[model samples]
Target: MIASSWLLVAFPALGALILLVGGRRTDAWGHLLGCATVIASFGYAVAMFVSSSLAEATDVALYSWIPVDALQVEFGLRIDPLSMTFVLLITGVGALIHVYSIGYMADDAGRRRFFGYLNLFVASMLVLVLGNSFVTLYLGWEGVGLASYLLIGWYTGRPSAATAAKKAFLMNRVGDVGLALAIFLMFSEIGSTSYAAVFAGIGDLSPAVITAIALLLLLGACGKSGQFPLQAWLPDAMEGPTPVSALIHAATMVTAGVYLVARAAPIYNLTETGRLLVTIVGAFTLLLGAIIGCAYDDIKKVLAYSTVSQIGYMMLAVGLGPFGYALGIMHLLTHGFFKAGLFLGAGSVMHGMNDEVDMRKFGGLYKRMPITFATFGLGYLALIGFPFLSGFYSKDAIIEAAFGSEGWQGWVFGGAAMLGAGITGFYMTRLVLMTFFGKERWRELKSADGREFHPHESPPVMTVPMIVLAVGSVGAGFFFALGDRLVEFLAPSVGALSEAEHTALPHALIPWLTVGLSLFGALVAWLIFGRRDVPVERPQNVSPVTRAARNDLYGNALNEALVATPGLWTTRFAVYLDNKGVDGAVNGLAAALGGSSGRLRRLQTGFVRSYALSMLGGSFLIVAALLMVRFS
Candidate 1:
């Protein structure tokens, strides 16, 4: 089993290498290998999850990788409920996304490169989830960042893709700085960087230092998870392939932040101030993302903002401390299923329409593509936290935790989250109605230039993944029955933090009320847009404020001013100083010495006669002085 754990990660890497070496000439093999690798890995994850659930604790530790007098780190794999859950998420959702990409990138010229990067991403994510220590985790962390950079810039010829990649890389670096600082603090405080050592040392550290470390880790989480201020890159990340967006933005990479916080629950549990900061940041980001998502017109952009919002909810639950860990992890699992399905469904629509992404251009697509529309529509409902769906169970859990007897602050944050849910429902309905319920708006399809275009269903390869994910999106929540088992499984690694009591609110009432609120939101959208008999008004038809919101609320401009401008100015300033200040000083000193030598050059100008006379005069003066001294 220990060796098999390594194989789970190695398989995808092997697939990637094979595709890189052999798939350049034949993409069929590339897709086949990529799909097969993820499926096999997913099979292993499932087997582990079931076996670990049924049997006693199952962990496989390899030989020590880091050994010191005071500290030791081993290369090991844990099959606890936490790691098992994430493994399923990575491999199951990842496998479907890989399979879907086969159809999504069918006509692309660089399909081989695409699959290669995709396989690499899956492998790195596996490394991240499987690692037993911070050092092993960091290896996967940096690996994912590298893969993201490549995949984001897959369309290197497009300026937007390049720009988005650079933005993501730089923003993540800002967060990574904090992560690095936290690692240093951990090593200094505990004398080790292993997860076991750090958790074990939590009680020995000062509360202030603990808070600082947690906050630093939170900063890094914010960057990876697409929280506010650092979140601007995700929307623009749609510049990559649709499958890339589905996999990284929706399913896996962005969720790393939540995983990081959950894995380090012990550190945050030690400090009240740290918990407060996490809650505040999480709440703020949730509301901010929901607000921004309400105004986006692009299909993928809307989903991107939703990803940010969903992660915010996860952070909120995690911030509630050890008690919320189960909630956070549960949401992570369900979110993966639903969001990945939605993004892929959207990708299928794009594929059918020849890559049109604007919601305004589509209408009444249900008749044209029933499977795509039904799956996407259902996915939207799941995201709105409607009753009985996977999202409802997880999201309601967070809201319930927020409203517990802790303080009004939790209640306030929870209330705001509830409002965000309604807004989520409203905007999703607006998207669905605008794109699929009204009259067909793209008359160009009937025109001479558009005659060649015909709406068609995605191939079975794509639909199969969508169907599987949709099923999971609808049903994965029932796994929460194993919550206690989960806690026990992770206790050795994550340790115990004060467990939060489940909310006192009746569970039966919560889902119904939230769903009612969501329905009201959907009704508003239906009334405002769905019933329109003629072409809807343009964005300008709305108020200037609404127009601004539709334009990402000028978040892009603020990002340029706050992040881009300063970064460029600093870089340019450093370049100038190196060229003009430091180099110029050395060159200036040499020039000055040369000038002084030139000024004194006349004295040495080939004057042999003058030299001889001066020597004779000096000799006479010396002889006269000596004679005078003798006479005296």
Candidate 2:
């Protein structure tokens, strides 16, 4: 009966306020309050989705937020298919995380503050997705970044947490510069920042100007999405709680980039160069993250790398231009399910153990936590684009869209993504077998009984979400193919993307090829890492060349030399120049003038007799000179 549109955002924000103010005294109620709000929002999101699904285009404008003489910004809620889809994702998956956190953070001293931040993040993300215009969207953009900073540094005691938070904030600030400039450009050209107005103006702009604006927007997306040089922060961001990891990395924060690009599909379509840049960046990031993921031993760190890699896939779809939007969105939704499940399942394992995250320490956990193991196994399989799961449907579609292109670009991108998938399978298999199938590697680890809690299961709260997400991971893809109704509903909002076209391939070919590729990758992984005597450990005794990959190669070294070292040395050099060069010159000049004044002081001696003699001598000389002049 209630208006499901605004309620989706408003309730969570209200809950955040309650938790912020009263969480300290509420004990378990803090988490209860937070979880309740997300659940309520999720219900509203579902209602809104169902309602919008039936309607043409659902837009609810509250009032004009920012109005000038030339342009007006209306505060409104838009629940078209695109926003509805994301809204359901954010709230539905987000609620599960909130429930998971109640168990995950039960013993933490800052539990209240943690729930408060979590609720605030969800609220902000809703704002981001439901905004009717760019100005409204940016409020949520900045808000989520701020929440990420807070949650990433939740454990202020750890230096790594603080450092990661700083890196995220600063890197995002750099991207935001480009975003701000792009906004200004849009206003200058279109006279409005509304999605409707800017998109309409995009068709009229010169290709060169459109490319510039689109590239600037891409810069912002890259930072928010964690691509290329800006991606360093994501791996280190594991310093936060596991729920924080699930929420930020998997479900909410990182997906903002995909949303931005997809939303701006119209503007990006105006420039060919901009579209190509998107594809290139996406392909590179996908490979880069997968390669790095292969080297990590830490469970969460591997997942972190995997997140960066998966996001790269989404970016690649965006690069494919309007033709790739549905594929990108589909992948984004499936990704939320599987990735969040993976992070939560990992958290459950960590909970069972005494916060141990290294895969090297775990072995044969399948017998202990069957639900967690099963859910996570499905998640990994889904993420690797294994057939029948959600990721397979979405990933294959994108690749197919790539191959359906006019030139060799499709082959180039499809090949790269396929290779990345193979590596993805290899690492994930190593992760799974090492943690759940092998002999327990760490005998030093003992249970509370001083024996071993070798195969433990998480509580009901944690397992419930994992189960639900796992189901979603396996089933979400069908919604895209079967729900033309959904496509029609969202058509107007994302009308820009409908411009690009692709070769109509047999629908059967994509799933089959994706299944074949994924199976091949899995087989390779099984052959390499699934062996019983697999060298008794990982390939730690590799050649020097191979060792580089395991050590993150020279990535850290490059960062130090390129970014950190230069900044440090520049600061020291500037200090030296100030003290020894500029300051010294000023001091030297002052000393010389002082010394000259000291020498001149003798000429003004305080001797009355000497002063009178000099005066008489001067008078005699003057008279003699005057007489000579007169004679002449």
Candidate 3:
């Protein structure tokens, strides 16, 4: 079974091809095929994990991928702890999302096409994780971008969805440029793009060269993972189906950055400055997302911002070098379980509430949606790092690791991470109270289309996946952290866990202090939202901080001021140069040639006397010059 590990990608790719090619003729059961394909991939992954010996990394070669002068690349799979870990995650969570989409998109006319895109996405992500070389990984990376664009813009009738998809594709392209250049640089410097060659050759290169490569790779990771400056696209991606949100934002695409940084641990291990930049970006982004999340009333957008914040934590973890690689993966795994559950739970609420996404219009829904409320509550608790929950085990470990860093770095990053946790608690608690605990605000309100609100539970197909993920949200941390099992298991791939010798804060007090801050944040939320009369219409007059948070802390405004405005003028200037400089020069030369030629053509008038006169004048001038020369 391990020998045929390539089939893991082939299965979903085949499903996507068949469904898409089959078109409306296969509409009746395309979704089933999609779900089955992912399930099969997941089952095969489990089989390989159980049967194979991956103590050292196992390379299964498919074929020679690129064969050029002194450059060689192979299309292959690396069966190891790191790749296998992502394989299980992509296929497992992907399979659930497929099943849930059956209920969510059941009534839509494009369900078949949606499932096809879903399969395509899963297959692409699988290829990304399984590939052993940078070029191969990039092939899958572009495939993911393509699939994501299709899925996000599925609702072609909606202008917002179309714009969001374009925004996502263009922003990701900026990062893709960085990744492609990194690969080209690797081939130039190391003469190979294979992981083994690149990692082994890093020792021979100068520190500056290695740092350059790492930073470029980090740029690509940030683009894909929704890190700062590239983050605005992700929240807007909520225009797609809720299941798309759960899969891309929660389980797969956002975590790709952490995986990249972790996989490149060898290079980062050699560069202190490179690692510090990553930590700084992660720390700032987490706070950015957390601050913005507290002000959103749109249920899905709030969850979208929450995803941005959590992925920030993961980035910060991986940015800590050897100390946080395994820890980052650990948080990533636990976050997958809980965050995916939260998004799905949000979908369930929307399903019952006629697709209304505002928390302002939602109130006391727990009575009508008991299963959704319970599951969402578990996910919420886990996200906020409630003690003994999955988040507690994974997140607190990251906090501990951050605080243990040397000198002022520890306090700055650690304080940022802890503060992010508190803000997460406050906003997520606010979301819960506004959506599930306050007075039934829907009683006095109507849905977007003037439809009456009659909230109820979602179908079992959707609820079941939510339930399983909720269980993970509750217990996955304990399982992964038990005996440090996950760390030891992942050691062979990322490297052995490194503990810092110095401490900015007592290591023992980290978890306690972290939990205390979260509780305080949650307490404030309860006081503000839970106990008050829930207002269906949000108030206009608010503090400056609240206003800033509501405006995404002016992230878009910053981008517009910095990138969009400059880019627009630069484009116009280029156009002007093309017209007045390049084209103008060419047109002037043409005009001059035409004028000179026209004047010369007048001498060729179709009259014998004119030709004779011109020839006689030329001959007389030549004769006079020759006579003068002879006389001299």
Candidate 4:
């Protein structure tokens, strides 16, 4: 099974190829193939997990990909506990999303293409996790980026979708540059890019070089994981289909960053500054996401921001060094379960409500869609750290780990994590209240097409997956958190957690504090939104803070001012230079040559008399020049 690890990626890749090449011919059953491919991959991944757990990390090289004089890169897969864990998440959740998409996209003419894209996304993410070398990872990294762009812009008719796709693509590219440079630096300094070679050689590299590499990797992680400075694209990505949202946010694209950081633990472990920077980025981003999530009316956008916050917790966890690497991955796994469930549940709601996304237009839907309501409610509970749920186990573990850090770092990061939990509870509760609990706003509202609103339950194809995922959302944390089994299983890759000598908060009190804050947030939201008379119209008057959040806290504005505007101006300047300087010089020289040739053309007037006159004139001038030189 370990030797057959290549099949995990091959299954989806083959499916994508068949679906894409077959085109409309495959439309009748293409989605089935897509779901089957991912399901098969999940089965194989489970088998590999069982097999790999009993053995050490195994490297299976398929072939020599790039074999230069000094650089030897192989198309290889690493079968280990860490990679196995991700394989399960990507394929397992990805399979569910594919199944859900069958119903979600049933009416669309391009359903076949959508499934093909989903298969491609799964294949790319599989390659990202399974690759044994950075170069191979990068190949899958770019593939994931390309697939995301395609999926996000799946509705080509929607301008917002197109813009969102481009934004996601361009922003990811910015971070990809960092990853690419880090790989180059590894090849130059370490003389190898293989995990084995790099990890072994990393010890000899200077601290500065290690820090530089770590930071670069973090930048790439941020872009993919929706972390700070590069997170603006994620909420906009809500313009994509909800299934795309579930796949990217929950199981595949965003988790790539967390995986990258965790995989590069050896490098990060070498530099205190690098690790601290990771912690700082995580803390800041979690708060940013939580705060922004509070103000969103678009249901999917709210979930999108929640994803940003959840991923931040993962980042913060791994940033704690060995103490939190496994913990970070644990949270990532649980988050995949609940967040994907939440998004799918959101999809079900949309399917019922004539595709209305604004929470303001949704109310008292719990009766119309009980399964979605229950599933989404469970996921919401898990997300807000409801006790004994998946999030409570993983998220609270991260908070505890944060507090375990010595000195002010612990207090700051722990506090931020705690605050984010509270805010998460507040916003997610608000979403639930607005969408499912209040008066039935749909009765008085109309859908975007100006049709009468009629809310109903989605078919079992969608709700079933939501139920399965909701079960995971409720229990995955408990299973993974039991006796620290996840931590021990991941110990070989992430390193063992050293016992803490001091903590800002007591271990026994951490969960209580987290749960208490979460309840507080939930209560506050219930008071403000659940019990109050919710309004349907967009308010003309609101707090400045609410307005700021609606504007994405001016994140896009800053990006435009800092990156896009400057880039546009620079491009315009380059065009001007090309036109006036480069083109002008070339055209001016051509004109001068043309003018001089025009006079010279008279000498070649296709007549012997004309040639003789020109020759005689030239000869006289030569004679005059010679005489003057002789006299001087």
lDDT winner = 4
Error of 3 at 303 (Å): 1.0
Off by over 4 Å in 4: 500-505, 600-632
* Number of the predicted model whose TM-score against the real structure is largest: 4
Measured by C-alpha RMSD in angstroms, how accurate is candidate 2?
A: 3.9
Q: By the lDDT metric, which is better: model 1 or model 4?
A: 4
Expressed as tens digits, the lDDT of each residue in 199-295 for candidate 3 is 9998899989988998899899989999997898899999999999999998788888888888888888889888988899899999999999999
Minimal lDDT window, size 10, model 1: 497-506
Q: Report lDDT (Cα) of residue 402, candidate 3.
A: 86
Candidate 4: give its CA RMSD in angstroms.
2.0
Task: Give the lowest summed-lDDT range of ten residues in model 4.
Answer: 497-506
Q: Deviation in angstroms for 580 in model 4?
A: 1.4
lDDT of 2 by residue, 1-632 (tens): 22447788888899888888874586667888889999999987776555545344455787888788877889887666678778888999999999999988988987978888999999999999888788788889999999999999999998989999998898888788888889889999889988878887788888888999999988988889888767877888888999999999887999998898888888877788998888888888888888888777889999998998899999998788666776787788889999999999999988887787877778778888899999999998889888767877787777777676557886788888877877787788888887888676655565444655445799898899899999988887766556444345556656533433523443457656666766776777677667763333456667774577666656667767898799999999999999999999999999999999999888688999888998999999999999999999
Off by over 4 Å in 2: 1-4, 53-75, 444-455, 483-486, 496-503, 534-539, 543-546, 573-632
| Runs in model 1 lying further than 4 Å from the true structure | 21-28, 53-59, 63-73, 445-453, 479-500, 503-508, 533-538, 599-604, 610-632
Q: List the residue pairs that clash in candidate 3.
A: none
lDDT of 4 by residue, 382-459 (tens): 999899999999999899989888899889999999999899989999999999998998898776678777899999
What lDDT score belongs to each candidate, Candidate 1 first? 0.80, 0.82, 0.91, 0.92
TM accuracy, model 1:
0.91
